[model samples]
Target: MSITRLSDLADKAACPRLVVKVGSSLLVGPEGVRRSWLGELVEELAAARARGQDVIVVSSGAIALGAARLGLEKGGRGSLADAQAAAAVGQIALSSLWAEFFGTQGYPAAQLLLTLEDLEDRRRYLNATATLTRLLDAGAVPVINENDSVATQEIRFGDNDRLAARVAQAARASAVLLLSDVDGLYDRDPRDPAARLLPLVEGVTPEIHAMASGTSGSGMGSGGMTSKLQAAQIAELAGISLAIINGTYATPIARALATGTGTLFLPRRKAAARKAWLGGRLRLKGTLRVDPGAEAALTRGSSLLAKGIVGVEGSFERGDPVAIAGAEGRIVAHGLAEYDSRECARIMGHHTSAHADLLGYAPRSAVVHRDQLVLK
Candidate 1:
């Protein structure tokens, strides 16, 4: 991987699809919403749109704004119920504010609330990706946030950093910009006089992770340098570059895209065609335990046949992503299922010729076509 400053970023032209994450600390304040800052941010977004790039904002502020509106204290002391309540109330306000700002610029805006499960579940993941693609194609900017109102500790993403990375993958974005209170990653905490900012990062190494302060934000946000590093790692795996910049800076988004003003973490390398889609990002809806014959066929680059599938585990839909396991229960591949769980169960151990008689309709011979399968 090559590391370069922001100066080189402008030369490559803006990415076709970009995901920008804005922290709660930058959008909210003790006095309420920061109108001036929001207006500036809107202008920046508009400029990007004018350049023909699709932009998605993964915003945080609902919980903080809701807490303030409900007269609750802003800190970790709040109960789970309290946090949920704040998110419920604040989401409306947050969405309204964003819609209003983008509306003024003549751009339509849509709200998307997601939980970790939404991205993990195969059906839901496809649905989310479809919605986002449709919205972008329709020239609408999507303002996404975690469904904090219903998210529990087990279901919550906790911070928007990782959520932004997931959004990038779902949207197939080329890059991600994380806007936070601090400018970028530093050799040490910026509070330390001896600390220096690292403007370009080729990869997130052990040394880089060590530099994280692991300190949460002062107000309503939960992200720290540690979370940003985690976000960078996710982006890297998805073949997306990520940048960390101080949201407080004037025109931060524009500056980051045009001049590389933030700390840019490059992807390790471009992902292989199959890995880009059915890789680790997708949640496995079920497992297909294939017989030794089928496993050998797969290894030889052949399509998966029903005769080779000895067992099917879990319930899933036809288009859902599932794990393909060998005789020993070790996952050897993953791909989009051509048949649903019930259909697979009925046809298991049978020849491909029996598919039409079993299901009363013939779609294809292979249970999973070679085109969709990605061997691990």
Candidate 2:
């Protein structure tokens, strides 16, 4: 909450705070961990570091990096266990490889492994933000990768594209550079003469989605134009700028950062959208009619207390999302109503401590807890 309004960030930083995600297709070539690619990336990243830019790399070459180094044929040629084993084995070498390359450039790199669960939970989310900030503060480029050796399909990020957006949000980055083999988002397959590259996107409109054709490039990755659009939407929602450009091009990222040459995705209309999406998590299962005083308190960003409930409507279970409304009929706040609708109805007009003996057992003190409530 103390972070800068992402929509208000300065245009492309003199020392840009960036979360750069590179897919496997661009990381490794027909041989493996293409020295040519890694060589170019290291020099550019090091230069950025020297200029005082903070960079966090959400890299995807791990699985492929692991597979190729382990001498496994294409990614599918191995079993799940085989893949995990390969990743476990390859990650060591992968980190060492990056560590040495970065060392050679007189910069230090830190390997930060993450899973989807790390970002989804609120407590873990805060902890992760703190850790990444501290790392960047200490001047270490965080080389983030999904903990693939243990992540199952159900708990997986599915692609680094989405992970990169989340990372950008966490880092409060000015932009997320999605470096792939393609130059930018195109109207059709760019390989075809009919396809056209879109230079700018205002918001993620349907037309923008239309231009997002399917996957193109070489890799064991499933991220296509569809996933890139998904990442773009995520970045937009967080009010972070994003660029999808070809990593294969020489000095691709440096050039984009210098002139905003790649496709520029404008930031979202933040305050309103943030109020709608990040502010509303639970579906309303019932309603609570509050007195004028409680309504005023809620408007000032206070939690809904037990004494506020004049009446509870409809059947809603504990932890179910509910709406708080005033006597004049307007929503005050959206919250997780603590007690079930039946129990809430029983204690509607009573204070929290007053309900214990009447029901033979004490229920939750507050009608709705603060942590469960999201202010409008």
Candidate 3:
């Protein structure tokens, strides 16, 4: 829907859920974590919670804080190993800051550290989504950050902006608020005297991409206007609205809501049926060859039954995404596996009722549930 006012994000029926991304510059100052600014932001988030909105925070500051604590220069952590070490040290500090500030407002904050694998792997993605749902259901704010300590340079997002968009997709959030150094997207270089801020962006077109600047000059933060643009594109594909605003001021979120002060990027359409990630975003781990009956059943929107499955290919774990092949090895659909490949091999021609006797445990009814399937 259209959201001309930032206040619309606070409405439960209208927006329901939101992901707020706080940049390292905004979170950790020269001294340490900006407690005063964070406290004010927490107060605003608490108000949103009172309004029945589920709030998730994607914060960047671990490396910045760690560098300061380790007596390293702002950009002194030159190696990947050094940066990862700093992240290990700073994660504890960053998490505590979030907990302390949110705790004061009577809200419990839950920390989630994710690497690229967590989002790229189907099983981990499901697990992360479940945990986020449970935390929000319990009225806790989920504070998320990339797991830099264990993540290699090849696997790191290196920016919280894109992570926030992925979190929005995972949590099925309606909106994302990116608090950065600049107020919003500008028509031209923000440093230019004639530049003008674009308040509402209908879509991230080529023109929009042209307006984006490079990464931040500030050594403390990695993301800049370009990363924010990438985040907007991700959110748009997930049918989540995203806004970027300068959070240098106190109570930035509250102020944005009150004055509609930001660049709001609207989604082109709603997310595809079920999760957009489940459609074609994931890498399939295995293949399931089903008989004619199963293929027909699936075509009619029925779950795949074990008795109708004839073969299993490759290795995969429960909750992993797999391809369902029909006649002539043509893939009919893709879905999350209810059972692992080895288990599927044993029960391929057996009925669900015999699963307990064969596997020595209770089993899920279907081999692949229709709810988790996307027809190809």
Query: In terms of TM-score, which candidate is strongest?
Result: 3
Compute the lDDT for candidate 1: 0.82
How well does each candidate superpose onto the true structure, as a TM-score? 0.73, 0.71, 0.74
Top model number, lDDT: 3
Report the lDDT of model 1 for residue 338. Answer: 90
User: Model 1: how far is 203 from its true place, Å?
Assistant: 1.7
- TM-score for candidate 2, please give it: 0.71
Q: Any idea how many clashes model 2 has?
A: 0
Per-candidate total of colliding backbone pairs: 2, 0, 0
lDDT of 2 by residue, 180-293 (tens): 777778777777898777777777776778777666456567688878887777676666777777688666666565554457677554434323333322235788899998
Superior by TM-score: candidate 1 or candidate 3? 3
TM value for model 1: 0.73
Candidate 3 RMSD to the real structure: 8.3
User: After best superposition, candidate 3 residue 175: deviation in angstroms?
Assistant: 0.2
Q: Please report how far candidate 3 places residue 273 from its true position, in Å.
A: 5.4
Clashing pairs in 1: 6-259, 6-260
Query: Which ten residues in a row are the worst by lDDT in model 2?
Result: 1-10
Q: Is candidate 2 or candidate 3 better by TM-score?
A: 3
